[model samples]
Target: MADQPTPDTSPATGSVPEARIVIENCAVATVDAQDTEYARGHVVVAGARIESVGAGPAPAGLRGVTRRIDGSGHLVTPGLVNSHHHFYQWITRGLATDHNLFDWLVALYPTWARIDESMVRAAARGSLAMMARGGVTTAMDHHYVYPRGSGDLSGAVIGAAAELGVRFTLARGSMDLGTSDGGLPPDFAVETRDGALAATEATVDAHHDPAPDAMTQVAVAPCSPFSVSTGLLRDAAELARRKGVRLHTHGSETVEEEAFCHERFGMGPTDYLASTGWLGEDVWMAHCVHMNDADIAAFARTGTGVAHCPSSNARLAAGIARVPDMLAAGVPVGLGVDGTASNEAGELHTELRNALLVNRLGPHRESALTARQALRLGTHGGARVLGRAADTGSLEPGKLADLVLWRLDTLAHSTIEDPVAALVLGAPAPVTLSLVGGQPVVEDGRLLRVDERAVAAEARDAARLLARRAADA
Candidate 1:
């Protein structure tokens, strides 16, 4: 809480020491500087921190060892980070099929307007559980819809994340512009500008944690340019800086969005965002698929980050994000699974594959993105986007022990000689273990905190109930 945890090569800060857990005989992809890899290696976890990570066997005489694990058939990497998502849409999957970005938002806003705390709690629980099983140790959810009388929606989702045991960030989002003002969301679905700003500040104050190993944090997100007023966007950015939290929003995701920005504000998506003081080191925008050279340069110059959602963009017919170009131009880039409504899988691991394949379909083929690049995007790249790189992104001695053990020895993946290739290009590898701050959240490819079956059942019921509520309205 007082300082960024010291770099791993140094001693544990302060006086309190932790019980140690060791894992040996595994393939390690540190995802650190130099893209370090070990064909056979060991990782030692001490309480909530990593004690050491190295090749060919763990150091001997490790004291205070509580549990020793043999990671023979698994490949260990920094836990995947989901930089952008909508956990509330977990129950709203498979809707607005065959629609573009504009049409999709219009179709879904009514049902979203009907959401209450119970439904969102169930939905977020299910969504986080799914991502955890897929090896997501750190997750961020952007929940923007605030219907009248929706009691403690952010609290409900935050509670679910705590129960499931993943490091989480709730980007308490808002929409102050509606169809009446030429925005995509319905009039009743939007909140007043003052109300939105006030609520966002309250959420940050109640939930945001400045600790290096915090379980939950909050960001200020005002939906998107089309769905939020210019004043709201401008004020939201200022408020986020005032509170010392990060800012998130949708940008340049679709041709329609770009056209809307140009028509309304006489500028492109990136330009309009900058006009409102929304571009900077502390800001990360979702789905920068439509960015041009100038926009990319602006992002690079400002040290802004991008959350690339490959599958979601493809699902909604949003073009491929200029990920290769953005990375080349020095813009920080990370991966996002987006919302289950658009990306029903809602898993971070699959984004690695999707990002690789989708970018190959972009202007630069083959060299668009490699398996290692995809792995980095899901791991350390996302850490940078969420402002948690120093603590949780890579496998270093003093960093938080947030990582995943992918069972690459399974029949589906065993044939692939390279562990990283098997993980990225091959079939979905089962997660044998996933840890957040040295705590086990998933084991044997299932959620350890909550019953997976029960979570799915709750989400199913919530989805059906939500449909009824929307229909009645």
Candidate 2:
């Protein structure tokens, strides 16, 4: 996470009728344990929770008591869950495209040092808007960048998510080790260990809601093993445990990072993370591109979650993760869009598609992902990683009414016979209707929140200004 912005009143969040809503005659992919697919279905949503999921028309009990949406040609699925992201990096897209991870960060650190409240807000709004438009209902943004004097960057991001109406988890990421102390980040970008811990606790107390249906929650993230001190990692884990917040950080993202861990700690990345007390059910690591067999087992044994960012990994030339092996070993896995700078797109639909292609390209092609499985990785898999599976992953009765309705009538999906296959393998389409906890956030392919075009224009301008500042610096 990283920068600046002011509050913008949301232009819309379509009227959420208090009465029940019955979506009839739709092709529904439940993505449940049984992988249920309904040729024709109806879902009754009362308040923010789903009342029932059944085949065919609205239940007789719901006749005139509910608002009925004729879903004759649409496909409805549980909203995609984005496990990890750097929302602030939306302003840094397309720069250092030819550079690998380390070089890319080295080049952008100075420019990031200039981010303020306004820039942070614009980036968050723009990023969330795109994600929402692309069918992401729940998201976790691991924002760790805190340039000196950049006041309350996390708060600004939380504010943006609130306005956008996405289920958000603000991973309060930190870096306590600077270049002077053998870390990758510059000194100005690093905070004192004590400062980081204090902020973590404060942020959690102020913004981390533990409710089952929480709209916003907080997590502890110390950037990565290379950017934070060993002591800080341990302290962060302890702090998060005490505060009852989830833990997150970059881990085994590349061969270079693995080598750094070996040289610095005399152990592999997973071992070093375990030494810092970060191996547990409450923790979710961003990348495990270089995990060994033992590392995969450890994640399974400890119940640690993995957030796989296929597009960003490919863009940065980071090696492919052993996702097939990890899933086989029982390690929970989810999909992420990663930082916008690396991916340059907030399209979670594309991420789902890349995940399908990347897994097939690897040696694990024998264990390659199916379209429905990839869809699961983006939904239930992500929910498990973010520790929110119980409430929002599948379209079961009593679950949250968070879902996306896609029009399969488009040229991109017109000829598809299988709705699920059409969704996963076909060209990505803007979500026709999106709802978060039964509240409409996108209606008929238009954002029901802020002015989408104005937000995009402002974010574009901000990105150009930030790029020029970085160049000048």
Candidate 3:
């Protein structure tokens, strides 16, 4: 067995200074711009940004000035980025596990309506904590279900991310079409179109940060075609563009969704989005499993991105997305775990592995997505989808030091085979350490920024209370 790497001994002194963090003796899989990999390498992290990378130890003159981490038998990569999620759904896992997309929504909508600000906050914290341990440094969450007169759901998520120390993009999603309006969601869960747009604007004005190293951002997202009016989608896209923020939403997630688009709008979901001006570089659609060749070409031409949620698609029996086709067409693609209710687990590493397996199941001539490609989907691909590629994707000089270290000596990854393949083909394990912007959120397989046990307990109580309310109704 490969000897275990010595634990990171660099003391957590005051905030890391502008000096570099020399991670010596480790095999660096730096997913640099040219897809370069330096086997026995070192990374120089200067304060919150990566300063430089080389194939060997630091030179004698530069050795003693900064903190040193001995990385003996580990694999270092960019921290995973989750392109789409619903953090509020963490408390609703297993509620409708056996149901399909529509049935699952019908069953869980009432429980979600019972959620308050505290529930949202607790669930967000718990989800972030879980993903952090699993090496997700940045995540975008779509919180669309707002009960009648419910306080700002986006605020709760923002507060949670602040407390938990993860980069977050809180997409203020809205559902304006209730059952009375021929939508799947009930009346209480849908917000008025005017109120939704106003709240979106308020969130953006107060929270959306456009800076290069922004820790938080806000996006405008009208829930979905079947749950929102055409006017709201177009207006949201326009509002997002005007605010200089991005747009996000669910699109063509299931056959039911495609059928609804065909029956209601007389076009496919992608065409409907195109007509509404929702197809562009600043927009990313989640769960685009039903898009055809034309849709893929349209996305490439317009520079639209896709958030491919393989696990959720499989769990909900929504068909596999044409990820290979999208990649071939030059459409940016990223990984999303979707929601805890559908995926049950929010581990970005597991999602990355699943994406590899699902893509390989397609035609033989189609290139099998490799572990390196899967890792890129979780890192660079996601950064591009979230409009942050200029800052956070690869481990180049001046990029934020958002990174993860996975121990390679574990039982699940014992063999001395390809390190990249070990990550995708072996059993999943929690990251030993995860850093976002040079700050450690998970160290030694534990969350360093929050109380994990207490958060889990609170989420359990909240879930029970909400489940009771749903049962009573």
Candidate 4:
């Protein structure tokens, strides 16, 4: 018999071309328009884009790549998008755990005023890593606290995001009214109206990216009605519109805010916003917990979005938002983790779970919110609020490949019958891998871009120093 031909073992001898990544034998949850779920599927990624997705083997005609990722026994979905956050507050978590929103602000304002560029950058990096581990790929950070001569804290946050490789919408938040001016914040924590506007313009000019798939963008956010003058809100809105950016602010977060609006502006929160031309598709407000039917109608008609921070609300004893009613009213609603000092966590997945449970407390009949609905609020709905739905929030061709892969072998999900439902009902788990714009920033449940433990330690030291400085002041 003729000698059997030995199998070719050379590196380039095989005809089977390499794939950038082959997520094989995984359950794919494509949160697309049709809400399709692929069980035991494969995802082929090439150069930061998903080349193909289907069940079974790769097509024979496909060509070469470099890496491959086995995603068997994992659940893959579009990454969670956090619509609202204060990344700086990660340094103040647990400081005001028992206070309401108003009292909490009063207690923390002085400490927040002590933040420098380095401290703010450390906090931003820590927050981003925490959120990424929780499966958040895109986040909108409302960083409004700019102490006098702190040296551009907003730019520090942008730099941190760039280093972390997470898509960031840095809302240039401003507060113009100090306690002397009948605002909630102290004088040191507030800026002059003109200074705030100038800073807003400078940040927008320097960092705002209007193009699709932008990693960083700037939104003009005048902190809130209680801490910002009417001129600031209106000017911020005008500036946002003029620059084609978005506007964000805290509105109707608590009953105290309603009273403040009534006493100062002689109108409800939503009405005050409308009177100042702040209601529009280009605007999204955080914590609309006390909005009424008229307010909801106005939001719907004006195409204004709302960021529902359920965990923060519950923690602060604030009433639940009329999320179901707001959804029924056709308002674009997204999930927000709010400030870490308020909610004590930056986990976007936990926010989605809380959002589902809180919405059920409403009087609406039928299912309050499906797991899929909750997931949408975290992904597509949040993308809509940040004005990036067309480029993110869904797994599709031409969109930025921002996504998370979660291991399903955890005890919480051991008996889950539906992987999608398990995501919302099961206990939260750290993301096994997280990607933004097709770049892997987190792999194997750890951040690949930064040393998280070191940053966390820095944050702890910074927080202690801030506390000491604030107390001395």
Please tell me which predicted candidate would have the highest lDDT against the true structure: 1
Between which residue pairs do clashes occur in model 3?
Answer: none
Candidate 2 global TM-score:
0.95
- Tens digits of per-residue lDDT, candidate 3, 130-190, equal 8888888998899998897667678989998988889989989999999899988889889
Candidate 4 TM-score versus the reference: 0.94
Task: Find the number of clashing residue pairs for candidate 2.
Answer: 12
Estimated TM-score for each candidate: 0.96, 0.95, 0.95, 0.94
- Tell me the deviation in Å of residue 363 in model 4: 1.7
In order, the Cα lDDT scores of the candidates are 0.92, 0.88, 0.85, 0.85
Instruction: Tell me the TM-score of model 1.
Output: 0.96
Clash number for candidate 3 = 0
Instruction: Summing lDDT over every window of 10 consecutive residues in candidate 4, give the lowest-scoring window.
Output: 1-10
The better-scoring model by TM-score among 1 and 4 is 1
Per TM-score, the best of the predicted structures is: 1
Whole-model lDDT, candidate 3? 0.85
Report the C-alpha displacement of residue 331, candidate 1, in angstroms.
0.6
> Which 10 successive residues of model 3 have the least lDDT summed?
1-10
Model 3 TM-score, all chains together: 0.95
lDDT of 1 at 204: 92
The local distance difference test score of model 1 is: 0.92
- Pick the winner on lDDT between candidates 1 and 2: 1
Question: Candidate 4: misplaced stretches above 4 Å?
Answer: 1-19
